[model samples]
Target: MTAEKRIPLHILREITNGFSEHSRIGRGGYGDVYKGVYSGREIAVKLLHVDTVLGHDDRQYINEVGNLLKVKHPNIVQLLGYCYEIQNELIEHNGANRFTRHVYRVLCFEYLQGGSLDKHLREESFAPDWSTRYKIIKGICEGLNFLHSCEPPIFHLDLKPANILLDSSMAPRLADFGLSRLFGGSHTHVTNRVVGTEAYMPPEFIKDAYISHKNDVFSLGLVMIEIIKGSSGYSGYIETDEVGQFTQKVLGNWKNRIKATSEYPLEESHQVQICIDTAMRCVEPDRNNRPNIAEVLDILSKTETHIPKRQMADVFPCPTIGLKSESNMLEIMVAELNNNEHIHCNLMPTDNSNRTVQQLADRETSSDVEQVIIGRTKEKQKILSILSESITEEMVNLPIYGIGGIGKTTLAQLVFNDPKFQDYTRVWVYVSQEFNLNKIGNSIVTQLTDKISNIPTK
Candidate 1:
């Protein structure tokens, strides 16, 4: 690891305006982070929580700085400088204020305007299409591979959406090395003190306290699934599905999305399938069953070969430099991927055999609403499927919520007009905040007044 500058606390304060509230940008387990200007460039400064970090021999701070110093990959967040200092400060002790020595530790990084990956995933109003999400996932895998490829490998024990930051281009950079660890020649280590976000922790770490590079794989699987499925956590039922079912279900979700939003649905759907297959394998319950980062990245790279050569630059915007693999090698990898026996190569339908999606399109009623809405196909199908399956003589109300211009109204219209529900009584009621049960009931009664006399209360 190269030596990093030991920035003085005063300089940090100057850049961050004495860590003012307005300058504060984010918070984490270790400390609060602030946006600052250093050497004419914007940077992020993380100030260690004095109580939690100062007394523990400062191992966490040192560990993060050490790991950051060793890495120089584009997908890895760069460490600009660090601050370690001790100063006399005012403190309250035993009902009196006194002066005491305070140890201040901070780390700085290049400012990324797109912020954390979790923010982009959490905002429901705006969703990036398949191409953007796929690149972010692939970038993360590449970063993880670089870490594992280090001579004395580094493992990001705390890998999750929040720990990944993005640039304006939406390319991801892995960050927050407070929980990272470096190992020499050992593949796995057992640590008694297992600490990380529990949702992303591998089962072995929670139960057996065993950690290997596959631990990161487990977290990456969850993160990738969340990315693929738009931050649903993929936590409970999604992870439990058998391989084939899960692949089809997720591929179906993206397939529907790509069909509506892409000029290249065929290639994009194939990419989604590869991602799901890799993600499922990454999350295998047995750590030994999970593929290493290198293997995971190898498969992800094959997506590039499948994409049209002209569109490859747009799909994978942040490809590696100074290295180009043989095109034949990638084709060989694709062949190996096809023969992997476990993978279900359900790409495009060659003929009428694949008319299922086409038939859904065929059945869609051409209504006054189009001009053709761009991205609500999957959601429309989901609502229709739910209504179809769960409409057994009971009132089913599914409330869709989002900010203005997210197509909540357009989706409602699509579902209302769909032929699948022609037999079922369809009542469209747009409710307001000052809602009245009698008013809504009266509207429902009015709609049903002419449509059916029975009202099918049965």
Candidate 2:
């Protein structure tokens, strides 16, 4: 462990603005954390509650500083410095001369702007994308692996979303090691007292006070499941079947958003299923059956990873009832196309086999757009006839060439929504001023998998 600096208490007070409530960021068992600016660098200063910390013989403070100094990894939070000092004040008690002493213990850590993972997990309107969430899970695994594979394995008794902080770029960094215990060449330890969150505790740890690396595996498993499902806590209250069945059911519940965002049926993806399999193995009832940190990392790092093809249609899926009008769809389509090369909309079909309309909100209706179109019957019939002619031949390129604001998109939408074309496979490609055949082909493949796009609005 490197030599940590000893910071003065007066400097900590000055930077934290006298530990004002405005500067406070979080509160834990130790004390309140304040955001401080030291030497032009933002830092998190945890001013330990002297009364509370002193009771435990300053064990929590000592453990945190010790662990932080010992471990240094990209995924683990770094310790900047610490302050352990004392202040003496002369006083008169009972009309006699006396002196009082105040001890100060403060730990400084790198400040993360994005706050904790728990904040993002609880957001209903906008959750992290699958790619970001996957990176976080992977990072957590790497951090745990590093700790468990040390010269003397360290057991982080408290590993949860609240303790995981996100940096400015949304990369996760594991923090809060007050509950961590280092084992000396021993794989497991037995203690009468359990000190960790109940939801993340393994059965053996809670029942037998047994502590090992497997305990961390169990916690990691729960965290992975919650992160994927966007649940705030474990779903232990829910009656669960076998691990496979439980995973299938969870994925089935999120199949709609998964399809629209991922552009691939997650249930059918081998890479996704492997994650489920690994999570199940980690959360096994028997610790002996569970995979260790190395095995878990190996399973998660499989090279047979599937990368979804970017599609225009998937980027801007079918126009939704949530949109205010045809103009709204046009605005969103244009904005998404110009702003981003890839987009994930919540409005899409539920599953691969079901193309029926799935409403985005409680007020959304399937016939919302149908009512907005006043007269397109003749236009629809003309497009249908042209499509019929092209279907009969081996291959044909039939384009409805027209000038701007000529109702080309409206005519196409009407024909596509017609009941006759419901059974036939359809692909919607919206080429702008610059046309790219490769992108269009990918869009077609995505549409074949039941992801449909809309006509471009010029």
Q: What's each prediction's TM-score?
A: 0.64, 0.60
Error of 2 at 213 (Å): 1.5
Residue lDDT tens for model 1, 247-307 = 7777888888899988778888988888887888888888889999999988988776535
lDDT string for model 2 (253-341, tens) is 55655677664455324455666677777778789999998888887676223342121111111222342453454455445444434
Backbone clash tally for model 1?
0
Give each model's whole-structure lDDT.
0.73, 0.68
lDDT at residue 179 of model 1 (Cα atoms): 75
Model 2: how far residue 371 lies from native, Å: 53
lDDT winner: 1
lDDT comparing candidate 1 with the true structure? 0.73
